[model samples]
Target: MEMQNITLSLPKPILHRVKILAVQRQSSVSRLLTQAVEKMLEEETEYEMARRRQMALLAKGFNLGFRKPASRDEIHER
Candidate 1:
């Protein structure tokens, strides 16, 4: 895949932490950032897909082909 370069500005403390994480994980900060962004996008996409599916199910509604039961007072004498 083709790759491009971009610039980002992060606080020194955050950058230091990212650098430490990179060392611990044996990965570069660039790769870590890429993975983070990819994961965020994937989660958002999955959430949207689930939301749309739920909405579709709601639109279709549910039916058991049975009449609803009567109220408690109707079924039992007080």
Candidate 2:
């Protein structure tokens, strides 16, 4: 894969915490951020696929096997 470098700015306190966390995990901050972004994109793609499937099912509708509509009087009869 081709790699492109970009600049990012973060608050000092947050950066400091991230640095510590990276060290504890034995990883670099860049690697941690990359993993987080990858996870977010994966989840978004999965959500979109599920949404499309549900929409298709709704559009296709379902069959309840009823041949004809019942009269209102029949429905209301005790």
Model 2 root-mean-square deviation: 3.7
The candidate maximizing TM-score is 2
Least lDDT summed over 10 consecutive residues: which range in candidate 1?
62-71
Clash totals in order: 0, 0
lDDT of 2 by residue, 1-78 (tens): 787888999999999999999999999999988888999999999999999999999999989786887899989999
Judge candidate 1 against the unseen true structure and give its global Cα lDDT, from 0 to 1.
0.96
Question: Who wins the lDDT comparison?
Answer: 1
Query: What does each candidate score in C-alpha RMSD?
Result: 4.6, 3.7
User: How much is the lDDT of residue 24 in candidate 2?
Assistant: 97
Stretch of 10 with least lDDT, candidate 2: 62-71
lDDT of 1 by residue, 1-78 (tens): 798999999999999999999999999999999999999999999999999999999999989698988989989967
